[model samples]
Target: MSAATATPARTAPGATTLPVADPAATRRYAWQVLRAHRGGVAAAAVVLLAGAFAGLVPVWLVGRMVDAVASDAAPSRLWWSAAALVVALVGATALAAVARLLVARTFEHALADLRERTVHAALHAPAAHVDGAGTGDLVARVSGDVDVLRTTVSRVLPAVCGAGATILLTVGGLAGLDWRFAVAVLAAVPLQVWGVRTFGRRAGPVFRAERAAAAERTSRVLEAVAAADTIRALGTAETHVHGVEEVSHRAIDRTVAGMRVSLVLTHRLHAAELVALGAVLVAGYGLVGAGAVTVGAATTAALLVHRLFDPVGILLSQVDDLQRAQAALARVVGVLSVPAPAGADAGGAGAEGAGSPAGHATTVPDDRAAATVDVRGVSFAYDPDRPVLHDVDLRVEAGEVVALVGASGAGKSTLARLVTGTVTPTAGTVLVEGEPAGGPRASAAVAAVTQEVHVFAGTLADDLRLARPDADDARLRAALALVGADWVDDLPEGLRTAVGAGGLPLAPDRAQQVALARLALTDARVVVLDEATAEAGSDAARTLDAAARRVLAGRTALVVVHRLDQAARADRIVLLDAGRVVAAGTHDELLAGCEPYARLWSAWHRGRTS
Candidate 1:
C-alpha cells in the first residue's frame, strides 16, 4: 500500500482538497442557528430546569423517612412523605419528556437551514474547485457528515443539556442541606477535569483522522466503481483494489484508536466517582457525630451526593460524542466556505427562475441572434509552468456549426471548455454575446453536453425537469421524441420509470439521448457538444449524431469532433496542432490547400476501408 493510496484523489497532482471551517467559524454559525430559534431554546431551558428540581424532591423525601424512623415520628408523617416522593418521580418523568421534545423541535429547524445552505454551496461551488476536489470529498460531507450532525442534534444534544441541568441542581441541593457536604463533593472535580482534558487532547485528532480516512476510502471506491470497465480492460484491477484496501485499513485503525481513548476516559471518570462518594460519606458521619447537623440533615446530604452518580456519568460520557459531532460539523459547514462562481448570489441562493437547481443567474435577457462567440488571444494552463493552449483565437457566427478538430492533447476539449464557460482562459478573454464567458450573461446563454453525461436517479420526468423545472409532461415527451428515445414506451410506467444508478440502467447511447433531450428543454442560445458521440458504438453513432443535429439546429454550436466525417459536415473546420490553429476552411478547401488535412483525410479513409 502506497502513501498515495492513503491520501487518495485529494492529494493527486494539482488537486486541492476543499476547505474546512475553522473552530471560530463553526461556533459562530452554531450561535447563529440557536439565535434563530431563541423562543424554543428558552422554553426548553425552563422545562429542563423544572424537571431537575422535581427530580431532587424524591431524594429529600427518602432522607426525611430515615429521620422519622430514627426519631419514632408519627406514622402519618412518614406516609405523607412516601406519597410525595411518588408524585415527584412522576412529575420529573413528564417534564423530562417535554423538555426533550422542545430541544429537538428547536434545533431541528436550525439543522434544516444548515442542510439547505450546505447543499446550495455545493451545487454553486466554482467548477474549477470542484474539478480539483473530486466527487468523494463532496459526497462524504453531504452524506456521512450530515448524518452524524443530524444524529447529534436530534438525540445526543438533548441528553447532554438535560444531564447538565440535573448535575447542577443536585450539587446545589447538597449545599442547601449542609455547606461542608457540598465542599466534600468538590473533591471529585479535579479528577473529572483531568479526565476531560486528557480525553479532549487525545481524542480530537483521532476522530478528525477517522473522518478524513473515511472520505479517502470513499474516493478510492468511487473511482474504482466508476471506471470498472476501463480497469478491467487495462488489466489494472489489482492495483485499484489494493488502493481501496489501504484506505479502508487506515480508517479502521483510526476508529479503533478513538475507541481506546474513550475507554481510558471512562475508567478515569469511574475513579473520580469513587473518590467523591468516599469524601461525602466521611463528611456526613463527622457532622452527625459532632452535632453540627441533625440526623435528618446528614441523611439528606448523603442522599443528594449519591443522586449525582447518574447525571454526572451521563455528562462525562457525552464528551466523546461531542468531539465527533464537532469534527463532522466543521466539514459540513466548510462547503459553505468555498466561493460560488462569478456573478452568483452569495451563499448560492441564485436568482429566482434560474432553470436548474444550481443554475447561475444572469441579469441579461435571452438573445439568440446576438449569441456569437469570439475567443481572442485566449491562452490556458491548468498548471502555471505547463501551458496547454497558447494565443489561440477562434470565432463562431450566430446559428453556425463550427467543428474543433485536433489530435489528443492538442487542446480541442480545453478550448471548448473555455468557450462554454466551464473554465476561464489563463491569459485572454472568451466572449459570448459581447460579454465575458463564465460571467452571468454568458452562463445564461450557454448550455453544454459532454460524452460524460449523468442520468440522475429518479423518475424519468424528474430527471428531465431539472433543465426546465416548470416544463409539463407534454414538453418532456416532445423533447425525448425529438431525440429519438422511442424506448420510453417499452418501460413499465413510461415517463414515471425510475432510472440511473440502481434503477433501470440505460445503454450509453440511450443515456446520451437523455442529455440531448435536456439540452433541448433549455432556452440557451449557444450549445457545446464535446465529443458527444465519442462513446457511441458504430451502430448507434448515426442515431446520436442525428439527435445532436436536431438539438443544435437553431443554436450556435461549437463541437469538439472525434469522427473526421462529423468535421467534414460542419460549416467550417478549425484544425489545431500543438496548441495552434494550423488550418481553417471547408473540408474540400482544406484538403486542396493543406497537406496536414490531406494526410489526415487519407489516413481516416484508409482506416474505414480496411
Candidate 2:
C-alpha cells in the first residue's frame, strides 16, 4: 500500500514515549512555562497595583483633615475632607475585590495548563524508564509536588505580588509626606534582606530534602501494596512493614526540620518589623518638634510606616513557600524537556500531541510482503554496570514464527521489547521493515501482548474498541471469538457488560484472553507475545496457544516462550543462555544436537509428566 493510503502513526495508549532529558538549568524553562499566560498575569498585576495605591488614599486624606482642623479651616473644607476619606475607603475596597478575583482567575488558568502538561509528560515517558525509576519519584511529583506548586501559585504568588506593590507605594507616600520619616523606615531594609536571603539559602536545600524524603516514603508504600501477595507468600510481611516504618520516620524528620527553619525565619521577620516601626515613629516625633513637619505629617508618616508591616511581613513569610515551589518546578520542567527519540517526532503539537522535529517524519511503508524485524549489535542494561542483553544479532523474516526459549533473566523479553520498539537499546539498532523500530511509523506496524493486562473501567466492548476504535460490535465479537474468549457471550450484558474496577470482575486468565482479543484486532504485521500466556490457567493456556497459532499463521512472530509447548509449534526455536543466543533450530533438531536445549527440554517434560 502507498504511504498516503496507510493509517497515520499514533502513539498507542500503552506505547513507550520519549525519555526525558536529565534536568539542566530550569529557571528559563519555568519562565517559558509561565510566559504562555503573561497576558493574564499582566492584567492581574495592573489591577493589584491600582488597588494598592487606592488603599493609600485614606491615609493621605486623614492627614489633610487633621491639618485643616488644626489651622481652623472652613467647615466646608473639613466636611469635604471627611467625605473624601469615606470615598477613598470605598474605592480601595472595590478595587481590592476585583484584583483578588483577577489574580485567582489567572492562577486557575495557569494551573490547569500546568496540570495537563504534567500528565501528558508522564503518559509519554518511556515505559522502561518509568518502570526502572519506580513509582516513588513520579508519585510524589504528581501529588505532593503539584500541590506545593499550587500553593505557591494560588496563595504565595498573590501574596508576594500584592504585598510587594503595596510596600513600594507605601514607602513612596511616606517620602512625599516627610523624607526624614521615610529614610528612618527604610533603614530596616537591610534587616529584611538579610532575613530573607539567609532563610532562602537554608530553606531551599531543606525543602528539597523534604520532597526527596516524601518520594522515598511514597515509594515504600507503593511497593508494599504492589508486592503484598508476594510478601505474604514468602513470609516477609514483617520485613516490608519495618522498611515502611523506617521510610515514614525519615519523612517525619524532614517535615519537622523544614518547619523549624520556617518558624525561625518568621520570628526574625516580626522582630525586624517592630524595630523598623519604632525607628520611624521616633524619627517622626523629632521632625515634628523641629517644626520641619506638622503634627498631621507626623501622624500620617506613623500610619504609613505601620501599614508597611502587613505587606512586608506577607512578602517575607511567603519566601519559604516560594523556595519550595522552585524545587517542585524543576522536576516538572525536567519532564517537559525530554527530547524526541532519534528519527521520531515527540508528537504532533499542543497538549495531547507530540511529534519529532519539523520535516523529520518517516513512515514505514505498508508492504506486508516484506514485514521483517532486525536487531543488530543490540545491547541493553537497566543499570550500566549490569547488562541484561549483550551484543546480540537477531532477525525474523517475513511470514516466520520464531520462539525465544530461555530461563528467567536471560534477556529474551528485553530482546522482544527491542524488536517491538517498546524500548530503545543502550547500544545498536532495531529496524522494522527497513526503518528504525523506535520511529513512529515503524512502531505502528508492530504489536506486543505481554503478561500484564489492564481492563479499563468500562464496558467489555469499550476494552475491545481500544485496539481499533472504529471496530463495530460485530467486529469486536468476531475478534473475541477468534481469541477463544467465549465467556464474553455469557456475560450479563454480553459485550455491553461493564468490567474492570468496580464492575464485573475478570480472572487473570480471562483478562489475558481479553488482551489476546485486543491483539487480534490490530493491523500489525510483526507481532510479539512476551510470556503472554503466563498468567493464564493451564486450560486457558491451551486455548490461548491455539488462538496464537491462528494469529501467527502468516505474520512475522517473535514468541517469548512462556509455555514449553509453544516452542514445538514455532518455525524456529532460538535458545538463549544468559544474554546470548546459544542455539537456533526446529524443536526436534535442538533436542537432538544441543545439550543445553536437551537438558531444558528434559526438565520441562519431567515437570509436565509429574
Candidate 2 Cα errors over 4 Å, as ranges = 1-24, 64-94, 126-128, 338-340, 343-370, 457-463, 486-505, 550-553
What local lDDT does model 1 show for residue 316?
A: 90
Model 1, position 95: C-alpha lDDT score:
99
Clashing residue pair totals per candidate (backbone < 3 A): 0, 8
Residue pairs clashing in model 1 are none
Please write out the lDDT profile of model 2 over residues 181-229, one tens digit for every residue.
8789877878788888888888877987787778778888999998899
- Model 1 scores worst on lDDT over the 10 consecutive residues at 1-10
Clash count (model 2, backbone only):
8
Candidate 1 residue lDDT tens string, 1-610: 0001112124766776777777777787787777888999999999999999999999889888888999999999999999999999999999999999999888888788878888877887766666677789888888888888889888898899999999999888988888999999999999999999999999888998888888888888988999999999999999999999999999999999999999998999899989998998899899999998778888787777777877888889888888998888888778887766564542211111122333334422333453799999989887566788999988899998999888889999888878766567888899988977767667777778888888889998988878777678998899899999999899889999999977899888888888888877777777888898874338688988988888788788889987889999898999998888899999999989999988888888888888
Error of 2 at 450 (Å): 1.6
